[model samples]
Target: MTATVVVGAGISGLSAAHQLATETSDTIIVCDAAPRLGGKLHRLALDDPADLDQGPDLVDGRCGDPALPFTVDVGAESMLARRPEGLELITALGLDDHRVHPTTARAQAFLDGRITPLPPSNMGVPTDLEALGGFLSDAGLRRARAEVDHEAPALAGDVSIGSYVADRFGDEVTDRLLEPMLGGVYAGQSRRLSFEAVHPGLFAAARQGGSLLAAAQQVAAAAKRSNDQSVGSAPPVFAGLIGGVSGVITALEDDLRSRGVAIRSSTTVREIRREPGVDHGGRFTLVTGPVPAPELITADRVVLATPAAPTARLLRALAPEAATALAEIPYASMAVITFVLADAELSGSGLLVPPGELPTIKAFTYSSNKWDWIADRAAAGFGAGTAVVRASVGRFGEEQLLQVDDHELARRTLAEARAVPGWQSARPLRTRVQRWGGGLPQYLVGHRDRIQTIRSAVAAVGGIAVAGAYLDGVGLPSCIAAARRAVADL
Candidate 1:
């Protein structure tokens, strides 16, 4: 029987394969270059066995009790509790009861050498100038206030989020306020990321408005109203699994195996060969395996769930135009430094570092303080006074920072952590660095148009599907949604 081949073992790939397995009787084969699954979502074992996450991590935050067990979610730690897809999948995998939420969702920002509560914002763009003045300079505040009286510049097709916000609030606000939050999500330079692609709601509001600040307020209010009207009296903002986010992947793998899908780790696809006139009876041949011992597998349909770079490489010969567009999509590398500190007393989720404030690191999270499960684990095994803090370094266009040795990088991060409040007296018991090369995709200006073009090109080729963090969003929900959509298309 002709099989369906899925390239990459990331959530996107696994989700697509799972969907196919559920919907059809076709045999599904999943391949990945890495010896292990879960891609960037991996967990590092801690001295306290209870703290180990099974896979790699995505985003970050911090906070916890001193007497708690210190565990770290080295990859993505939480999902939007409101997004039903991730929860639905987790429940379907018999992990429904594992759902957990952060003890505290409040966060702060490190600005100009001081810690300040992040201003009320609509994805980094502040809605209230008075509240944000503590972080902004007099000039920055003036520029922000001026946005209300002034009309936003006419943006034609597509514009960078930074350019659009800067035109309204000047560079200082964009650099200090908007950049940190947006940078945290995309690891992209605001000047390059598309406004429409990154903040569609705000973009739509801006298009309808006389001023950006007013538009942002409207958007925030609408979101609040929508959230208030959501099914429950109150829905959680984010959710995590009891064991860890990696548990989700583990559960998924178990479920897929039970469904008769073949998951091959350490298998990389070198190229995809599209058969001519196969739109009627089309098939794809995948050249995979390492080096000289390459193996070929033919598939009735192919779903490329890998990141843009490798996907582009594989499709270079088969779908040149789509490959070109995929190749043009830029990526950013980042490193997460998880530090175990004894007798730590930090509170709140974490601190976001604005551009130029801390060139070496982007953000930091107090793990023990943020998640109760981590706190309980630490409390149970390690007794009290143990803390786990995670900090991330590197950004788009900042490859030099990521080139340093892990030891050196950890030293630099620890040194910087000392500067932040509550971390002054704490000493690290252990430190680990996880480097994610080409981890984040930048949604640059004209990104939507480029995606449409890519979609059209791929459709013309037929029997192929693409899904990943590069398309809809960089979060788990977005990847899962995109994966399901891709499978439906096939």
Candidate 2:
């Protein structure tokens, strides 16, 4: 029987493997170093069994669309509805019922030892020069705006996002606003990220306007127009599961299994080799290990969906050109500490933090207040507000990831949170820590060219491909979409 070997049992791998099984009638085996699946898409049912949350809850992109779950995406909360791949998958999977939106509860960024509302301008683009900075001088803001272009650049070349931002807006904007914003997104230092790859739109806009500041103004106005159109939209919220973030995962995994998809957890694949055969070309062989020292399963194709580092290693022998290109991408480790408190604690909405606000906390999410899942628990409290707030330890590779243990991190977060006027009254009902050593992938400025080369180099190989958040967009929608793209090739 023809089979497909998929490395990494994460969502991307799993989804592609499932498609391979259904489309080609091929037996598919998904392998990962970890016992469980889901990659960065994690759902949790903490000490409170009733409440389910996304650690650092990822937000949903279909914030206003109905005909779905009215998804309250709080954990890892983000969606690139702009992308086509994910939306297509949702329709294919018949998850139209699962789609939904969560309440944003207003976002704010902390910097210079104070919390300020992040401008609600489109895509965080500054519409007016006055909106440039509490940090930059008037002249600096004007100069920065004069440099921005209004269109996004293509993936034809490579440039550091820092260089692009500096050339367009000056060093102050790059260091303070953009760097921190990107840090929160990619968890990598901006200097290393390529601007052409990461923010193509901003790059093009800068080129058009001769400055990012000017591009921001035009983009901001356009964005405002879009926002006005979406104002009275239905669901008008971010999407998530009815219970906790895990609810959807549990349901989806079980559904996949019901369709005859077998998930073998805690398994590892030592290596993938080509089996020379005349029956149907050369079959791809996967050497099973940690089970048998050298037992092998031959397959028709293979999908390398692991993180960039491991992917680089796997393709080294089969497609060295592709492997080397894959190796160029870098990763940043991250840790999350979740503090679930009673209603008496969380006084209001959530908060964001800009870069340079160090030594204590990086970002905090008012879980109980943002989504109905946690809010229901908060409402159940002793006539006061108790909520779950997540504190991220590192953005630009901070020491907190290495320096603090669970208790210490908790203590530090609690104390630092008190410094924020709204959350001072909040205390944890339960606490937990989730650390991802190589959790997030940083998209550097040269990222596009490097990835393009990697993809091109790998394409020369037959029946082999790669897909993940790192390849496409860096959000849930992107991940889902990437998985679908891999399936199309199969």
Alpha carbon lDDT of each predicted model:
0.81, 0.61
Residues forming the 10-long window of minimal summed lDDT in candidate 2 = 57-66
Q: Write the per-residue lDDT of candidate 2 for residues 187-300, one digit (tens) a residue.
A: 766777766656666666555334455566666566456766766433242454445443434544665676665666666666776766433336777776655366776767
- For residues 1-490, write the lDDT of model 1, one tens digit per residue: 7689999889899989888988899989999989989987888755532222222221122333444434456878788777778988888888878788888557888888888899888888888889867788887788778887775565566788898788888888889888888888888899899999999888877775478888888988887778888864666788888767878888889999999999999887888886666654488888887668878898999889999989888878767898999999999999898876765668788888987777588888878778877766765545577677789888899988888776677777877778877878775655678898999999999899888877777777778889999998888988999899889777
**How do the predictions measure up, each by TM-score?**
0.93, 0.83
Looking at candidate 2, what is the lDDT of residue 7?
A: 78
The C-alpha RMSD of each candidate to the native structure, in angstroms, is 4.4, 6.5
Which candidate's lDDT is highest?
A: 1
